[model samples]
Structures are given as structure tokens and as C-alpha cells.
Target: MEIFAIQGYVDLVVFVVLLAVKLFAFINSLLWSAESYEAAGKLTKPAWTIILGIGVLLQFIGILFILSIAFTIAAFVYLADVRPALAGLRRR
Candidate 1:
């Protein structure tokens, strides 16, 4: 059906967007130091870095249904929640 075709395109767009988010989060995580993460109220920088790194690799492999959702939540939480807190501290 025409609707199904449209939905497929929509899904692909969403996936690509999410993948970009994950990659950005992963790169930032790698760039940030452990003390920065801790000051941002994050205890484990390596854990998040690894999580996002694997998430990106998996997305590239195109095996991202459950793994994508789980890691995407983690990545966004770090980006939206933790990164804001870190930025606030840096502005001081």
C-alpha cells in the first residue's frame, strides 16, 4: 500500500536521526574526561562511552531494534540531561 511505503521511509528517517544522535553522544563521551563526567553527576564515563560506541556499531550493522531503543534512551539521557548539567558547571 502507499501508506506502508511512506511509513517505511519515515522509519528510515527516524533511524538515521537516532543514529546521528548516538554517534554525537559517543564522540562527546570519548572527548570528555572522567572528572568532567563525575562533576556532571555521572559516575561512569567509560560505561556510557562503551554503550554508545557499541550502539553506533550495531546501528551500522543494521541490527538495531531492541539494542537501538535501549542505547538510544541511554544516549539521549546523557545528551539531554547530563550534558546540560555539565555545561552549566562549565559556565561558572
Candidate 2:
């Protein structure tokens, strides 16, 4: 395959994966209350929601979308690390 074609496919995959990540984070945030975020020792609920939402929006903005992945780091951290802790807390 042409290098350009290969690169384009790679970019597309990145875009889709990031979009899904942010979307999942945003949706998951809805299941938790503001207190849950705080009790979970994570970023505030609204702050995290906005961050995830912006990450999703950035994905549609031409080449700059890739930079949005920086925000995903935080969102994913909450999802992967914090959310589980929060779930465990709720079960207690």
C-alpha cells in the first residue's frame, strides 16, 4: 500500500478509537453523581464531563483532533482507575 494510504487508515482508526473512548467516558460519567466523583477521589463530575465532551468535539476538527487525545488520558484514567475505585466504594 502507498504510505499515504497507510497513514490515512491509521489516522481513521485513531479518530474512531478516540471518539469511542471519549463517548464512553462521557456516558459513564452520567451514571455517577458529583459526590461520587469526589468520593471516588477523581476530578469533579462536571469537569470530567466537559473534558470528555471537548475531546469528542476535537476529533472532528481536522488534524488538530489528534491533540485531543491528551484529554483522553485523564478521561481514561478516571474510567480505568478512578471509576473502578468509585464502584467499589459504592458497594461498601
Candidate 3:
């Protein structure tokens, strides 16, 4: 298959996966906030830790999404620029 076509497909997949990540993050944030934890049991340290852990996980997940975006962009840039440069070198 052509390089452009393959890269386009990969970009589309990344976009869809990112969309799902956003939705899940929103839901999890709502579920892990103070109010949600308050509804779980007496407002204790452990309860707060659970809430804080959720926040940390959310941040980690956000980082993963950012990295995924970076990699996806890099993939396209490599295909558009680096690959062609390598191809030119190969033809010499």
C-alpha cells in the first residue's frame, strides 16, 4: 500500500482512540471527586487517598494520551519528511 494511505489510516485510528480516552477520563473524574468519595463512607484519610489515587491515575492517563498524540504526529512527520530523505539517499 501507498505510504500516505497507510499513514492516514493510522491517524484516524489514533483520533478515535483519543476520543474514547477523553470520554473515559471525564467519567472517571466525576466518579473520583470529593463528593463521590464522601458518598462512599465517613470522610477519612483512606477515603481521601482513594480519591487522590484516582486523580493521580487520571493524570497518568492524560500523559499517556499526550504521548500517543506525539507519537502519532511523529509518525506522520517521519513519513512525510524523513522517509523521503532516506529514499533519496537510497537512490543515490
Candidate 4:
């Protein structure tokens, strides 16, 4: 019983962290200009916005775990790859 309780807490932490990352990615996507995405050779701003938005929404609802994981991967891609490309353009 104690182990189950600990596992529940761990699961809750994971869920919260996933939601935070998705929310951050969605918000950051909104901050960049459409032109910045084009200049960086990434997807259009609207596309990213929609993708991240859906991810955040799905994560928040917490019903479909598989879909949530898929969207989480999308968030990671935006943060790890597309974000740096856009940030690079901003620095130059």
C-alpha cells in the first residue's frame, strides 16, 4: 500500500512536468514571428502553434496517455531542434 502511494506521487510529478514542458513550448512558439520560422527553415508559425496547442490541451486533459506521450515528443522536438534554429536567427 505504501509503495502504491509512492508510485502515485511519482506519476503525478511526471504528469505535472510534462504539462509544464508542453505549456512552455506552446507559449514560446507564440512568441516567435512567422518570418522567423521561415528564415530558420522550420515549419510555419501557425503550424507549430496549433501542434503545441493541441499537445498542451491533451496533456492537460490527461485522458489518453499514449497521445500525451506523442505530443510530449513533439514538444521535445520543438525545444531541442526548432527552438535553437529560431534562437540562432535572433542572435544574428
Candidate 5:
């Protein structure tokens, strides 16, 4: 029983963290201009916004674990790749 309780807490933490990441990605996506995305040679702003938005919605719905993982990867991709590319353009 104690182990189960610990597992539940761990699961809750993971859920919250994933939600935060998705939200961050979605909000960050909204902050950048559409032209910036094109300049960065990435997907359009609307495309990323929609993708991150769906990830956030799915996090809330909490129905499909596989889909959640997939979107999490998407969020990370945006954060790790797209974000840096966009930021680099700002530096130029």
C-alpha cells in the first residue's frame, strides 16, 4: 500500500511537469512572430501554435499515454531546436 501511494505521487509529479512543459511551449510559440519562424527556416508560427496547443489540450484530457509522449517529444523539439534557431536570428 505504501508503495502504491509513492507511485501515485510520482505519477502526479510527472503529469504536472509534462503539463508545464507543454504550456511553456504553447505560450512561447505564441510569443514569436510568424515572420520569425519563416526567417528561422522552421514551420510556420500557426503550425507550431496548433501543435503545442493540441499537446496542452491532450495533457488536460489525459486519455492516451502514447499520444501524450508523442506530444511531449514535439514540445521538446520545439524547445531544443526551433527555439534556438529563432533566438539565433534575433541575435543577428
Candidate 6:
């Protein structure tokens, strides 16, 4: 059980760290794409820019939600596995 708890914590930490990296990548991709489109002069149209922005925002939100769900599951598993042992350890 102790070993499982340790593994769980490690998994949770890794998940969060990876999620952060992914989020950074997503934001950078969106910004770069938008800038590239603008540089090409196609992004001059307000409507088109708005449409692209909304689409990118939606995609970003979706990815964020997915990452949040993944981390939530990892956290729940870690807590469930380790709470008992942690409490016991505290008593000593």
C-alpha cells in the first residue's frame, strides 16, 4: 500500500508537469498561427480573425478540460490510496 501511494504521488506530479508543458505548447501554437496568418495578410479581415480566435479558444478550452480531467483522476487515485497511510504516519 505504501509503495502504491508513492507511485500514485509520482504519477500525479508527472501528469501535472506534462499538462503544463502541453498547455504552453497549445498557447504558443495558437499565437504563432495567428501571427503567421496576419503576416500573410489574410488575417486583416476582422470577421476572419474573430472566427479564428474563437475556434482557437474553443480548442484551447477543450484541451484544458481534458487535461483537468486527467489530473483530477490522478489526484483522486493518489488521495484514496495514500490518505490512510498518511494519517497513520502523522499519529507517530
Pairs that collide in candidate 5 are none
Which structure is stronger by TM-score: 1 or 5?
Answer: 5
Tens-place lDDT digits, model 6, residues 1-92: 89999999997786556555444433333443344434444323344334334434544455565645554444343234333333444366
Kindly report which residue stretches of model 6 are placed more than 4 angstroms away from their true locations once superposed: 34-92
lDDT of 6: 0.46
How would the candidate models be sorted by lDDT, starting from the highest? 5, 4, 1, 2, 3, 6
Tens-place lDDT per residue, model 2, 22-78, is: 778778877889998888777888888888777767765644645775877866887
Clashing residue pairs in candidate 1, if any? none
Clashing pairs in 2: none
Which ten residues in a row are the worst by lDDT in model 6?
Answer: 77-86
**With candidate 4 superimposed using the best TM-score fit, by how many Å does residue 56's alpha carbon deviate from the native?**
0.5
RMSD in order of candidates: 1.6, 2.0, 19.6, 0.6, 0.6, 19.2
Clash count, one per candidate: 0, 0, 0, 0, 0, 0
Taking all chains together, each candidate's TM-score versus the true structure is 0.85, 0.81, 0.35, 0.97, 0.97, 0.37
Native-structure RMSD, model 2: 2.0
lDDT of 1 by residue, 1-92 (tens): 99999999998998889889999989888877788888877757888888889888887777857987888888888898877777777798
Error of 5 at 79 (Å): 0.4
Residue pairs in clash, model 3:
none
Model 5 quality (TM-score): 0.97
Better of 1 and 2 by TM-score: 1
| TM-score quality measure for candidate 4 | 0.97
